[model samples]
Target: MRSGARAVLALGANVGHRAQTLHAAVEALGATDGITVEAVSTIVETAPVGAVPDQPDFLNAVVLVRTDLDPHALLAAAHAVEAGLGLDRSTKVPDGPRPIDVDVIAVGDLGDDVVLDEDGLVLPHPRAHERDFVLGPWAELDPDAVLPGAYGGRVVDLLTRLHHGEGPA
Candidate 1:
């Protein structure tokens, strides 16, 4: 059997029972094959980012999991959970409100960096560091968390930098 890889996942919900949706999503992730949720951050409320305005604020949280599934497989599992939670990708607007959103923040060490722009999956989420909704809760869960890639840095540092308007270097 292959050893499980440590992964970080960001969760958010803005429509219908936000907190409950986040909780259920975490539970669903734990119940998935080859995935075991080890830790979860406290959920925080934040205004939505990007386009698609005139929506409710979001409840966001982060989870750490040990998984035997590879990057793409894990992404598939996340999408499955979203589907089960009634997140219809077909009808949803880009960057719009949703019942649930799950993003693969990072996977394993990969030491240098892991870049995958194909197959609808991106490792070490391209914009994770820029979003406080992702970094804030993540920092609470793992103070020492360092994003795994070239643009990566300490989670808390990234959050601080963002707060100071420094952005990622």
Candidate 2:
């Protein structure tokens, strides 16, 4: 394994033991070979957002991890964790309800933000800077968190901007 690099993950679930599923995800990530669960933000319940909005509210939280795994490998682990906890993306509506959804918010150390664009993974999570579900919990977990990339800055500031209606559309 490589030396540990930091990564932020956002987890949400609106179906099947939402809180428990998020907790289990934290435990699972902690147990993964190359990942160490660092801190977890308080879970927040919020109305569903995105294409499919007529769904149950979602319980969302952020998990910070220090990992030796590369970005893609870490994402694979997240997907595996989601699958193990009952999320079947193949059968769900796009942006619809699911038992668990794990998203990579950002990857890199405290000051250095990594940028990547691939088929299924995009670092700094293209829209993380805009989603309160992601930003709120992230700000709570890491007070000094910085999101690197376009539309990126201090997490707190981003969240403030989002709340002030200053975020991207």
Highest lDDT against the true fold, candidate: 1
The models' CA-based lDDT, in order, is 0.89, 0.87
Per-residue accuracy of model 2 over 42-154 as CA lDDT, tens digit each: 99999998899889999999999999898889988999999899887678677899999999888884323355446478777877877999989999988898888766888
Q: Worst 10-residue stretch by lDDT in candidate 2? A: 110-119
Which residue pairs in candidate 1 collide? none
TM-score of each: 0.94, 0.91
Alpha carbon deviation, residue 86, candidate 1 (Å): 0.5
* TM-score, cand. 1: 0.94
> What is residue 83's positional error in candidate 2, in angstroms?
0.6
